[model samples]
Target: MDAERGEGSPHGGDGRLRRRAFLVGGGLAALGLGGTALAIGPDGFRNAYARVVCGGVPDPPVARPGARRLSEVEGRTVIVSLPPRPRDRTTVVIMFPEGTENARASLDLCSADRYLAASGGRFAVAAIDDWPSADVVGTVLPHLETQGFDTGRIGLLGWAAGGAEALRLAAQLGSGRVAAVAAASPAVTAARAPLRDLVDIPVWLGCGERDDRAPQTETMLKGLRALGATTEGGISSGCQDTAYRVRVLPEQFAFFSRHL
Candidate 1:
């Protein structure tokens, strides 16, 4: 749903262009039911607002075949989906679930399993359900290495709150360990200290035009670009929920493929 920013984009001559493109394309649909109509009752209002502004409540994602749950990895739940025929030094994309969603929800929301299966096994996908720490990667990487994945090349994908976590991880792990990062509707309001660690890493960020977090994401994107960090993506159609995040997944994966 997000506009691809390259040499030329509709909103502006440069990538600094903001939400006009997405709003022009999807404004009406994004304003579904209108704000007044959604303010009727608490539950009704919340659901309506979510649908119109936070992306519709998506159905639970069905698990694709070849997906495996590995609870033994550092005693934490990790869902891994490998390519049907993986290379001995296979690259891996590690996904961080948003908020309280589990690893499975992360995989389903982003459709990482399907992406891997349909994309000809270019890389493996793993999702973990931990927060605020980079230590998980230390254990997860070694485990993946034993399982035949190349731990050296790694990509990180994070949603909403997880986006900040991904940035933090990439910073803590450094570019030597983390190849790239893709953050969707990230909760980051400004370029924080962690960003200082990512100047060498390619970071792709996207958010919905209607999402409350869009402005923050835009600010972050601009700040990153100002800092000369390798960045892409801006505001997109839809909101801050699963639908919008899912819409941005393809570009994220593509970015990872090019970097990781």
Candidate 2:
């Protein structure tokens, strides 16, 4: 979470109003994790942190005709949907998160939507809610087809735990429905047998500079290279935010655009 800054004035015409307001606001911020700062403006107090977290946030409802909740896997319900323009050539993104199913942090599929829409409607993006499950992907395929997507051209985008899942699913599919796989901040380790072999499709892996799991990502990349896979690794400057390294998504978009 990012730190916050705030400013305010004291009431009752106190000479120390500004100083007092600063102390109070600072105290309030100290008690909270992921607090944003505010400043006293002509219109009164303004919160910068709230702006960052809530800025341009979209509604949670998936309102398209084919946009509906699918059956739950292991008690967690998954969502499947098609882009607004369904007839275009489609690409599927199987998203898996590193947190609880209900958290808003896992709702970053908006970026994926934007990417597909910008690509001449050449792709459709679908975010799966369950952890690395091939069954979930299989279940969502028909739902995507109902939305008019070409499931044969779909791709996978996995982050953190989902990255590991993406690799597993890629190997499981073996170039069937999946065209490529992109793993951002993948929690790849030597223990996974499926990830040991290099995937035949294009694979892109990335991590953050301040991420504690950089070593694990590097190990996974090395393993993929050893398997004769077409692989690329990227590094971002910021720390992990909501299980995603912000820069990795755009890069992944470019990779998918080129390969998928």
Candidate 3:
């Protein structure tokens, strides 16, 4: 879900644009979700396609303090983290990372611990080796609900391709069940999710000016807004596509906090 700076984004830079395509196996380990195995080209398609095309902002590392657990639920593997004591009205954050390599790294990048702390232990975080999408939300959603999470307070976060995947899940599940969705430099090449279905969902897109993926994200934001989804995004000057996931994480945390 993060990356380095590049030049020539139409957002105002003059460098050539670059796009990375990923091919992942179901076993690839993702940020804090436990590692899943991957099969990719030696050229790094697994890493590149999983990240967004952009350019750089720096921030403190994203880490949470608590015990981490890996287990199986309903035939799927999941990683869960909780504050020593959780509060009532907990928000459930389900995330997908930018690449197979950063699967476990996603927990900090998405500010899972910060949410738990900010909400006074009112957030429970969970992630899986494979993102819960149209193919799996049916199973993942019900399983999470059975585990004591408020299905109505779900939030979805992803980096690069994951962001678009989050949007796809939001559309499939409907706003009645999802509260917020966030994406950073997502590698979404098409708008496959039905905008009409996101009328009441709140979505936040974070990307930098120097990042080449800004236009696509901004376009998606515009589409979501036009379709009446409550949407907002931060377009920071000099922010790189690779770096925005961490750099704008604080902003993302606040957005999810308000919506969740």
User: For model 1, how big is the CA root-mean-square deviation?
Assistant: 13.3
Candidate 1 lowest-lDDT run of ten? 16-25
lDDT of each: 0.72, 0.58, 0.62
TM-score of each: 0.73, 0.63, 0.66
Cα lDDT of model 3 by residue, 56-102, tens digit: 23444444455565666666576666654665545677777766533
**RMSDs, each prediction?**
13.3, 8.8, 13.2
**Model 2 TM-score (2 dp):** 0.63
- How much is 165 displaced in model 1, in angstroms? 0.4
**Which prediction has the highest lDDT against the true structure?**
1
Predictions ranked by TM-score, top down? 1, 3, 2
Record all residue pairs in model 1 with backbone atoms less than 3 Å apart, i.e. clashing.
Answer: none
**Which of the two, 1 or 3, has more lDDT?**
1
The residue-level lDDT of candidate 3 at 241 comes to 43
Error of 2 at 202 (Å): 0.9
1-260: candidate 1 lDDT, tens digit per residue: 23455556644444333343333324433665544433453445446556655565444334344546465565667677776666667788888768867677767665667656654546778877664443566687887788777878689888888888888788888888888899888777674636677888899988889888888788887877888999988987887677887767767877877887
Candidate 1: Cα lDDT at 194:
67
